[model samples]
Target: MTAPSKQTVCIVDDDAQVRRFLAEVLASVGLVAEQHASGEDFMRRWQPGKAACVLLDIRMPRISGPEVHDWLRDREPGLPVIFLTGHADVTTAVRAMRLGAFDFIEKPFNVQQLIERVNQAVRLATDKSAAGSGNDGWQRALTRREREVLRGIIDGKRSKLIAAELGISERTVESHRASIMAKAGASNAAQLAAMAAGQPPLD
Candidate 1:
């Protein structure tokens, strides 16, 4: 869980007391806390690889929490966010999940529960970092041309359409696809699509 010493956290919420309360609790655990009053403030100061997690309020006066998440999605911070929702919903929660929030904590969460969930989220983020290092070799296994061909295959393109785009023969496209499927351990278009999207092998 990053040894607790090296991790920094950000508590982003509009409420002054929310920020202070979070900051104190985090300090008690030997982690760093940098508080911000709004999503924009957090985004302005945020560095990509620095923080471990964000305790963000889902509602704020300007630059709401969900927008802040969308901004960070491309940044790909090691930071996993546990959202604070004053008015939680099935649809809003689902959107947050789809956008890759670590967890959704309803308002008035217990101190121990928040701490436990944060610890779990940090562990997950660290595991993802560890696993990525081992897959560096596969990162370059496919050439640019091969990737484009794979995309076509996943899109259910006929060999002729792919070939015409790449200025290659349909037979050549087929041959390249065969090689791709074998290397990716995929049996069909759906499998190929999953691989292309960087997903794990389907059961």
Candidate 2:
């Protein structure tokens, strides 16, 4: 069978063995893998296209994964980033997620889970690229809380249910819903949900 895309899975880790293992795993799943010894090396080769996703080691000499992620945020915001960490901490995971990391996995990650997240990220990035420009504006306009509410709504949850899930009051959820609709320029809940799911708004 053919590979998913010609784009490569760029792995940035200081350890040679880890890089080798990850490359092998990705190959088994029909993904092209490219290795870099450090963040600087990866940055030197980074380009806008043909990168399915980045597997970045959290700790590296000189430029760290978080720093690389920050740079990518400005240079290539559409690129998906997945952090690899030897020491998994709540603080680090939360921070990485906040910065748009697809997912964070520890050193001894489950092979299945790793493949799943990587493939999922690749698919999501591909969809975003295929979607063109309409989704970007709505995505950028949403606040974090509004995003959470939109997700719940998209999952077919009621406003009260979404509020409970987010640990906020229903009124707050309603307010967020209103703000999200305004920002997305969606006429109704259905249209707002469509916009959140990366579909173009209806006329």
Candidate 2: stretches off by over 4 Å: 1-6, 88-90, 135-148, 151-203
Candidate 1 residue runs with Cα over 4 Å from true position: 1-6, 88-90, 136-203
- True-structure lDDT of candidate 2: 0.74
Candidate 1 lDDT by residue in tens digits, 1-203: 36553367788999998888888887887768889999989988887667777888888887888888778765653356778876554357445643456666777768998888777655544554444444322224445676778767767788789999999987567656644443343444565676567533222
Candidate models: Cα lDDT each: 0.67, 0.74
Clash pairs, candidate 2, are none
**What is the TM-score (0 to 1) of candidate 2?**
0.68
Question: Per-prediction TM-score, please?
Answer: 0.64, 0.68
Clashing pairs in 1: none
Q: Tens digit of lDDT per residue, candidate 2, span 165-198?
A: 8899886776566545534445457766675675
